[model samples]
Target: MKILVVDDEPDVRTLFEQRFRREIRSGEFSFSFAYSGEEALTFLTGHHSEVVLILSDINMPGMSGLELLRHVKHDLIPPPPPLVMMITAYGDTDSYNQAMELGANDFLTKPVDFTALKDKLHAISTA
Candidate 1:
């Protein structure tokens, strides 16, 4: 499976890489990273057919994840939209509700727990 990971922080990218290295190296999954929402859109435009999922940070500099989510749901053409899961430091009720209303497949808090994330991924993938 191909996954797009969008986050501004280098450390977050590194951590994701580390957490999923086994899958990546073993050919179970592949990932591409974008530093901003614009970059994510660019990647999607080119790799729309390949990408099956997106893990996005909610508090980006130029375009927030919610904005990205809206664009993914409303603006993209062909190949259908990939499943998007919003990750945020602000894990409040309002944010979670908004994310779901905006069409998020799932919501995860910052300092992401890999086991929980993996389980969610597994469930989503199987479905």
Candidate 2:
């Protein structure tokens, strides 16, 4: 599976790589990283078809993840839309409601639980 991970924190890339090293090495998953929403959008435009899922941080510098979610859910009309999972340090009800309303597939509280994330990903892949 191909996944796009978007976050302003550079360390997130290394963290995910370390956490999912086995899966990546075994060819069960592949990942791409973007530092901002705008960069994520640009990557999607060229490689949307190859991406199966997107993990995005809500509080990004230029163009929030919610805004990106809107574009992914509405503007980009691909046949098999990539599943979007929003991650936020502030897991407020308002943000949760807005994310769900905007068509996010799932919401994950930071720091993410890699075990739960793996289960969710497995389920999605099977489905």
Candidate 3:
């Protein structure tokens, strides 16, 4: 599966790499990283068809993840938008509600639980 991970944090790329090293090496998954919402949009515009899912951080400096979710779920043309999962460090009610209203496939809290994430991904993949 091809996944695009959008976050402003530079270390996120390294962290995801470490966390999913086995899947990467085994050819079960391929990942692409975008440092900002804008970058993620650009990447999506160019390669949305190949991306099966998007993992995005909700709070960002510019063009927050919610905005990006809007674009992905509502703006960018044609049918069949990629499944988007929102991640936030703040476990608040408003953000969660907003994300769901914006059409997030799932929402997760930060310091992401890799085990649960893996399970969710597996379930999504099979579905």
Instruction: State which candidate has the highest TM-score.
Output: 3
- TM-score to native of every candidate shown: 0.94, 0.96, 0.97
Locate the minimum summed-lDDT window of 10 residues in model 3: 118-127
Please provide, for model 1 over 1-127, each residue's C-alpha lDDT reduced to its tens digit, 9 standing for 90 to 100.
Answer: 7889999998777887899888778887788999999999999999888999999999999999999999998899884799999999999999899899999989999889899988877776677
Of candidates 3 and 2, the better by TM-score: 3
Model 2 C-alpha lDDT versus the unseen true structure: 0.94
**CA lDDT of 84 in candidate 3?**
98
Model 1 vs truth, CA RMSD: 1.1
Runs with alpha carbons beyond 4 Å of true place in candidate 3: none
lDDT of each: 0.90, 0.94, 0.93
Q: What residue pairs are clashing in model 2?
A: none
- Clashes per model (N, Cα, C within 3 A): 0, 0, 0
The TM-score that candidate 3 achieves is: 0.97
lDDT of 2 by residue, 1-127 (tens): 9999999999999999999999999888899999999999899999999999999999998899999999988888575679999999999999999999999999999989999999998888778
CA deviation > 4 Å runs, candidate 2: none
